[model samples]
Target: MKKLSIILLILGLLTGCSEKGTYIKNTTPYDEHSVENVLMSNEHVKLAKVLLYEDELLAGIRVNTFSRFKKKAIANKIQKKLEREYPDLKVTVSADSKILLETEKLINKKSEKNYRKKIDKIKSIEKEQT
Candidate 1:
């Protein structure tokens, strides 16, 4: 009975550690909800998707504008806000329709590799615009 108690204690400790580790893994560098709220508060934005990957931020936002010329301003505004708020993070923002579509695809295939690829694509797209 003493040996069984010891084994049970070890098992309980192992389970507790796993749960704590999971909480850390799930947490973002910043307050994810507040970040989302800040972006959504913009009058021009319709949809804003923000994901925190460690210290980097990957945001795909859809602004309420049919004019292509207005998109650049909107994207730049978002990029500035994120950079200002999270100086340590490598912030990448996009108002491009193509980037938005790609982001939706990543929602289904969520892997670190996929996020890296998506960020690269968004940056490339951002470069082309600017």
Candidate 2:
């Protein structure tokens, strides 16, 4: 009876747990080298690809982009850069609540150089309110 109870407890613990939220992962093992970065653009249209792939992005990602660039162009540029690094991953541009919700699921990546940007929709509202 004691063994049965122990087995049931173990099974219950293992069955209910899972990792949630968005995150990037290296398909390769530790011996393989890997890098991750997040770029920024003024328009959501520019971030379509990244946002589309938000499921793979961990929080606190660092992305680079040309300052004062068009939305679509910036997205295209980022796609080009990512292609060079990860050709296997398909990237697309999509600006919508679905992608943002996925991004929100990511665990923030921490670094000395903060790449985190203020989400635009909220920023614009603040601007109007002020």
Q: After superposition, how far is residue 109 of candidate 1 from its true place, in Å?
A: 1.7
* RMSD each, Å: 14.8, 16.2
Q: State every prediction's TM-score relative to the real structure.
A: 0.65, 0.31
Tens-place lDDT per residue, model 2, 1-130, is 9999999999988764332222343323321122234343232222222222222222222222343335335545555665565555444332233443444443243331322243333223323532
Off by over 4 Å in 2: 1-69, 93-98, 106-130
The per-model lDDT (C-alpha) reads 0.65, 0.37
The lowest-lDDT stretch of 10 consecutive residues in candidate 1 is 18-27
102: Cα error in model 1, Å:
1.4
**Hey, what RMSD does candidate 1 come out at?**
14.8
